[model samples]
Target: VCVPPESVQPPPGSHLPHLSSRVMANLDDGTQIGLAMSRSIGDPEADRLGVIPDPTVEVMDVGALVQEAAEALKVESEDEVELLAVSASDGLFDHVTPETVALEMARSLYEKEGAPRPLLAAERLIMLSSRFWIEPQQVAYRDDISLAVTKVNKGGKVKA
Candidate 1:
């Protein structure tokens, strides 16, 4: 359901397209649901030419993702896993290490958003990094991680 800016334009001489209303509603909803990636071109020439940047929206079923991850990791319950989503800004490169960036993000979430910090301290941490741009646009990468905690039983044994 990717509604590019170019695709949402009204026909020449018309007030609005028939599908514009529905598309706008979907895009707005996607943005609120964290399924949309909005990026603007930083090139001055492109901006002067009236280039409108469109957002890329992807809808994901989180339940299905958790189930798949649990199976892949051979975990008994999905409740043992936590998902962390973080976006890297232009200043991210100033950090010394990826771990530092991750820790800062986690701390911010805990302090600002009141997110539980213990979830971030899970035993297994899977980091995924994605680069969106090559240059000027900051060459930013969005990092997402799945953290899972394996429960331990009495007598110092790990429970499956």
Candidate 2:
């Protein structure tokens, strides 16, 4: 569920900056969800804004996730596999940024299982562009190496 940005309270000693009241007021009339900012993510703008990184790390069964994805993509048992991690967020102040979620997921997987590196090194990370005015109701998953390569080559820009 989404909440107004004003309703989100930063944790104690958090160095992250909150969204300005003016920006909050200018948002659509729908509930606002603030995205957690990370100053240490090496983004100059994020550091300048004093955004705090998300602290929550949710660990999932990577094998299970991969299996589900493989099944959905109709891959054969002997097919080579790569894992693409995608995070989706409704464009709102209260929602966590898709980058943060994707990063945390990769970090957690690396620390726990140590297999996603080869997958990630193969350029398998994907972050869906934040959607405005609509939440994702369903996703059509496909494994398109050419598309992924093109996105990476273009500096990760998703065409609308």
Candidate 3:
């Protein structure tokens, strides 16, 4: 029976000549290769036979990666960590410390007890605000005073 025109017609523009064999065998490895009918390389029946290039495999530069890792380790692990992070509520103040707060409290208490009459709110605030900061420890004491002042400012009565 005569084959259909669509089935018999070769691919467009590939110049590979039609050899006797349905599949061309490689002399080096006896593996068979088919014609490139799907590719747009002109007529396949007249195309010349040649060696196809093999896919390349790339090698990773492991020595460079190791050197970079060693440098990073050397830099990061050199010195001891300096400043330790602490919570804000850990008796630390912006400018006053716990010892200074204690000293101020002592001074205020001494002034209050020495006074013949009770101190007014303005007078108490004046005593607290007049304190000068000397060190971080002093500022830390003021942290407690800050809390106390916050409570008082919020309309909570200060306990004796």
Candidate 4:
């Protein structure tokens, strides 16, 4: 999500030096998601004003991508993989950026095909990353489920 400079405002009572800091975070599987802090969803105000979807194709399965790359590259560990988000603008932040975490793995796969759809890569990464947000039972079963969020969270304890 990208926020315009004009719309960005600090919380009700806080004094920050400037606007627009880049925050990048890496997930357990090594996918990087980068967020333009000033414009990121962290701040509801900024997010509501303006936000943009990533242009690159997202790769959801970061770990799977790494494994695939490792196998393709003949590398032993996920650490051996390196990725760069071509669309990520440069900046700094106190915490990891979601875009940085998300795009890293996407870039790796995109690069294999000579820089294809960056947004598409991002989407793919997101889909794969859903593996971690899944229910423990689903993970164990390795089966598709359409359980409602309420039921899933309560482990079927909630009464209808």
| CA deviation > 4 Å runs, candidate 4 | 1-116, 135-160
Clashing pairs in 1: none
Better of 2 and 3 by TM-score: 2
How does model 2 fare in lDDT? 0.41
Residue 42 lDDT, candidate 4, scale 0-100: 45
TM-score, predicted candidate 1 vs. hidden true structure: 0.30
lDDT of 1 by residue, 1-160 (tens): 3355555567878965233211122354455222222334354443333433544446666667667868887888876544445433433333224565556455544454664454443311222222322232464444333332232222333445
Q: Rate the local accuracy (lDDT) of all candidates.
A: 0.43, 0.41, 0.35, 0.45
Candidate 1 accuracy as lDDT: 0.43
Best by lDDT: 4
Best of the candidates, TM-score: 1
lDDT value for model 4: 0.45
After superposition, the stretches of candidate 1 with alpha carbons farther than 4 Å from their true spots are: 1-50, 89-160
Candidate 2 per-residue lDDT over residues 1-160, each given as its tens digit: 2233565657768876444322111257767555432323345444334553343447676566667757887888513334444433223223445455445444544454654543453243332322321344244422222111111112233444
* 160 Cα displacement, candidate 2 (Å): 36
Note the clash tally of each candidate.
0, 6, 25, 45
TM-score, candidate number 2: 0.26
Candidate 1 RMSD computed on C-alpha atoms after optimal superposition onto the true structure: 15.9
